[model samples]
Every structure is written in C-alpha cells, then in structure tokens.
Target: MPSKNGTKDSMLEVFVYAAQDYGYSIDITLNVHGSLVTGKIVGEQEYFQRLSENFKDDSSETAEKIKDELLKASEDAKKSDNNNVEFIHLKNAQVYVGDTQPTPSENHFLWRGKIDDVNGFFLGRIKQKN
Candidate 1:
C-alpha cells in the first residue's frame, strides 16, 4: 500500500535500507493531490522498539501514541518548502509479495516498494550513489 498521500502510478522510484527489528528505511515519490512528494524512512528501529514496548505492555495509550508519531513522521517527510521533495520514516511495515497476498509474517524481512505520502508531481535528477 502506498502512503496516505500517494496517488496511483504516481510513484516513480524508491530506495530502501534495513532497519532494526522488523523495520526498514523506505523512500518513494508520488503525486499527492497535485504536488510531488519525495520521502524517506528514518529511524525505523527506534519506531519499532517503541511499538514493541507498547505491544508488550498491551498499552493502548502507547499504541495511540505510536500512531500519532507515525502520522507526524509521515507529515515531516512530506514537508518541503520548494514543493519537490519529502521524506518519511516507516516502521513495522507489513510487506507483500508481487501484489498477490500479504507476506506470511509482519516481521518477515523484505525490501518494500512503498509510498507513505504524496504531494505534487515533479521530475528531477537523481544522483547515483557512490
């Protein structure tokens, strides 16, 4: 599933990195409303840890807090003054296989093509990683 803000087929590219404990670093581009939003997942391990703590204690409050934090993170990723780039951090991601079915386990590790949000559509040069 794309981020709350991504539009269909608007996503152009993505990058991902392994984060700790069922988490990952994800980047995506999509058109949200009318703007292009580029975002990256940050500090995924920390986010999952918080969620783990909450689940361990069965703390509804903590879960709610986690949700709020995720939304904030998404918003933070979408924030851009120039209206071109956005960044997002996603944790505890539920990855799927080939758009067929949800992966067997939420904790199962995989690199995901995801969209956490979108703004407008823009084409920009991507520098190759050295």
Candidate 2:
C-alpha cells in the first residue's frame, strides 16, 4: 500500500522539477517543532541570475516570484490530503547570488514571515554563509 504522504511527496517532486525548469535549484531543509513542520528552500545565485536575465526583470523581483511559487507549491501539498499527518509549511524561501560565503554582495534576496505575504525582503549586499 502506498504511504499516505505520497501525495505530498509527489507535489514536492513537481515543485522541484518546476524550479529546475526555471533554471533554479531548490534545497529543502525540514524541521519539526512539535506539531508544526517547517521547510526552507534556497535557490542559488546562478539560477537567480539566469531567471532574471531570461525574464528581463529585477533580480529581486524574480527571486521573490520564485519564492512565492515555492511557498504556494508547499501550501498546496500540505492541503493535498486530509490525513492527520503533519504538513510542511514554508519557513524561509530565498535566493542567493555568488558563492555561499561570509562576504556581502549586491545579490541576496529573501522572503520571510507568512507565506501568504507577497512582499519580499531584500537584504541588500549582506554576507550569507550557506
């Protein structure tokens, strides 16, 4: 018998493919705190740059849009089944430009707070390690 969480897994796979198609690689980290599950997805800078150049938009805007789509995919997966198992919620979605070093660059973008909030937080040229 298939696991009840199959639907969620399938949905996540779809998101991963979609992200890859958009020239982004998604790294997901899952953390469980009590009854809540938090998932964080980070898209590397190369992908962000490619997406921005392809879409002819600001890198910040492009990153935000990507994060939004990821959050929506996660939410949809959460609601995919009515089972009582824990569902993952997006805790942080971000796009980083340049290598994951402790050096500041003009290409770090992030979206925090609730997933429903369409606004993205731009941490201008901040040092990010991984």
Candidate 3:
C-alpha cells in the first residue's frame, strides 16, 4: 500500500491464484477502474484471506465479490495495456503517492509500484540471473 506521511494509503484489494482451479489467495490492491494495484508479493495466504475478508460481508458474499472484483480488474488491466509488468530498480523505487519504500522483504526482488497514479497492484516476476 502506498502511503503518505506514515498512514495506510487507501487501496483496492484483489486476489491471485497459483492455478486457475486453485483458490485465489493472494491479496493485492486495485484501481477504482478495476486494475490490481502493484506491490511486491510479500504476504501469505492467511494474510490475503484476512485482507479479503475485511472487504467482504460474508464467506459466500466474499466469493461473489471476489469474482466480480477480479473480472473487473482483469478487464481494466487489459484495456490499459500500458499497465503491464516492468522492471523497477529496487534502489530507485518509490510509491505513487509517497516517496518511501513500502517496507519490502529481501525475499522479493521486484519492488511493486503504481503506474499512472492508477493504483492497481502487480507482481513483477523475479528477474532471473543467468
């Protein structure tokens, strides 16, 4: 989440699945237009569930809402083709609404940052070194 002055910057949350049939358990931010907001994949399934549950009313409602949000976010992301993945230099990284790094872990190589001030979350695949 992008923050200014040490506050939780408002973000729209969405889910990611390890496989299409597997449950979508990753929590990420989304743009109002329905794109997943960018950030490093630093959290786990429990964290994602907690975050998703926070935004939903009930388990059933949560699933429905998740699907809706995912569809909308996917379409929005597709429409804005320019919003796809990119290489962000970790040392040169910054949040959209703030100048500070989002307290990432060393396990994550790609620092997730917003594009176009749209506020969707993305996972930059770890760059492989040959």
Candidate 4:
C-alpha cells in the first residue's frame, strides 16, 4: 500500500521493524514528495547506531548531546509498534530531485525521514555508475 499524509504503509512498517529484530534488508526506491530516494531499508537500531558512530569522533558537547539523543531514541524504537513508528530509515541512500538522476557522490550516508512523506515505492535500488 502507498503511504498517505500522516499515515505510513503498514506493510512497510512491518518490514522495517522486522529488520530491527532480524538483520535482513531490502533495496527500495521511494517516491517521496516527487523525489526519488534509493537505499536499503534499515532498522531503527541500525540507523541510530550508524548516526551515533558518525558523531563519535567529535568531542564537542553538541555532538555528545546528539549521540545521547540517538541512544535514547534507539532504545525507545526497539519497543515501537507499526502504529507508533514515525520514520523510515535508509542506508547508503542517494536522492534524485526530479526525473533526472543527479551526479552520484562517492560517499553514502544514513538517511531518516518521516514515513508518512513517502507517497509510493518500488522494490529495487538504483545502480550507481563507477
């Protein structure tokens, strides 16, 4: 089912949360508000874990605070249900603003966005050029 305003696809929610419990992932391309975002759907635990690591090298207080928040959210999400889950997380995600593909960056990053914002989606990832 496609996502609607303020509501996410229930099937997608189950898939994402399952990834949290198990370590399986599926490549997906989401039509998000007229934009295409391609990546592997990841669990909240993995999402927060990666985000926390990204800030580990920074010793700034703000970074620490962010890390703390991520930790809290991670723990909270572990107990989340499909009805309560708010966001979708992706790994190695790349964004295409319109019909044309943008220049692919060498770096891939973790991305998190509101699940309700996704209008449609498909079951494959875009292959990047070398």
Candidate 5:
C-alpha cells in the first residue's frame, strides 16, 4: 500500500527501528501491478537468523505480531487513500514481507496478505498559507 499524509514514512520508521533492534537492515520496494499497488519488504539473512532463534523460544509469536503490524499499516494506508497513483483504478493489492534466508532457498515469505481499497492511499498534500 502507498502512504497517505506521511503514514507510509511513519510505517517505514517503525520497520527501521525494529530492524535496528535486531541488527539488520530493511529493504522496501513499491511496484505498480496493473491498477494495484504492490509492496515488498526484504529482511536480510542475519535478521532472519535472529528471528528464527526467537521463534524457537516463542513459537514465532513476535514475528507474527510484526507481520500483523505491517498488515495493519497497509490496511490503514488503503483506507486513507495513501497508495500510489497507479493504483487509482484498483480496489486493493497484495503485499509480501519476507526473509531472504529461506531453507532450501524456498518458502521465504513471512507474511503475505491483501490490502483493500488501495485507490485512496495516495492523497497529495495541500499547500498551507504562511
């Protein structure tokens, strides 16, 4: 989903903070899929390793929470018309948040879901009077 009223930036900040906590970096990419807005978040190998370690102790509850948070942010962006202009004709789009350190080089996705009503996620800012 795109960001509206700086919400996208805010969400990125959250991801950056979380990634830093685990000593990893986050890579985000936005793409246009027909009239839909698609997004991908890639967390590197070290991050995945740490996440796996945590999952062993907590059954991936933390990872689930993070995924939920990201999904929620996407949903919120959709609701607020904060998506990219190319998505103007689409009602929703899919987002993938994954780790690159998949075993056997497959099954790398940590979270995958749809964000609805993405057409509204890219409202432009209005100029203010001085």
Candidate 6:
C-alpha cells in the first residue's frame, strides 16, 4: 500500500530495503494505479547481473558501455543508505490490463517503479503462461 498512516507501509518499505541490502527477493503482484504488475522483487546487483548477462558476448562498444554503466549504478545503490526505500525493482515482470493473454510482442522484463505509487499488493505474483 502507498500510505497507511500518512507514511508509506513500513512493512512494504522494509521488504524493499531488505531486497536491496540482502540480495533476496519475493514474488509479488502489485496494483499500481490501474495496472497489474507482477514479478519477483530483486536487488540492484542481481538486476545488473541479469541485465549484463543479456548483453553478454556483444563486441560492440555500446554493449560494453551499457554494462559498465549498469555495474556502476548497482555499486552506487549498494553504497548509499538513506533508510528510505524509494523504488522497487522486479525481474520477469509482467504488466497486465484486463484479462488479455501474453504475446510475443509483450514479453516479461525488468521493471522499476516508485514505491509511493503502489496502491495495494499481494504476497505472490500472477503466474504468466508464456
């Protein structure tokens, strides 16, 4: 939930903070505005690792640059400690509208969203059959 008593849900904030600091994740489905976003919450380092893997074996300068930048961002996130969780990161993220099924054009991907934007959430994500 966005806010419980004028402040964001402490438990949810703790969840995100733990994921960022401990490299652990939990599958969750969230209601953001009207969209249904479902995914496995992951740490910044794990996110970068998965992303770098996707860009691996590309000899292009652009690919290397992207990987390096992501690595740096991951490191920076780890070092910073504001004690306030601002963003939520997810892997194998799927966003749905209504009852539509997944298509090749709409594949699961990494997602990052503002914690304050979430309205409500559940413990587990909706399993996509793609």
* TM-score per model over all chains: 0.24, 0.22, 0.23, 0.81, 0.21, 0.82
lDDT by residue for model 1 (1-130), tens: 2233435232432322232223455544334454333334444335433444444555588776776675665345334222222333343333333334433342422122333343333333122222
CA lDDT of each prediction against the hidden true structure: 0.38, 0.35, 0.34, 0.80, 0.34, 0.78
Clashes of each: 18, 0, 11, 0, 9, 0
> Whose TM-score is higher: candidate 5's or candidate 6's?
6
Q: Write the per-residue lDDT of candidate 6 for residues 29-58, one digit (tens) a residue.
A: 888898888889997767777777767889
The C-alpha stretches of model 6 lying farther than 4 A from their native spots are 1-7, 103-107
lDDT of 4: 0.80
- Candidate 2 residues 32-88, lDDT tens each? 221222224332323333333433444577666876665565455434432332222
- Using lDDT as the yardstick, the better of models 2 and 4 is 4
TM-score of candidate 3 on Cα atoms, chains taken together: 0.23
Per-residue lDDT of candidate 5, residues 78-119 (tens digit): 344222321111111234334222222322334321322222
Deviating ranges (above 4 Å) for candidate 5: 1-59, 83-130
Ranking by TM-score: 6, 4, 1, 3, 2, 5
Worst 10 residues of 5 by lDDT: 85-94
How well is each residue in 50-75 modelled by candidate 3, as lDDT tens digits? 33444466568667788566556544
Least well predicted 10-residue stretch by lDDT in candidate 3: 12-21
On residues 7-102, what C-alpha lDDT tens digit does candidate 4 reach at each position? 668777766666776767999988889888899989887899888988888999999999999988788877765446678899999988865654
Pick out the ten consecutive residues of candidate 4 with the lowest summed lDDT.
1-10
Overall local distance difference test of candidate 6: 0.78
In candidate 4, list every pair of residues with a backbone clash. Answer: none
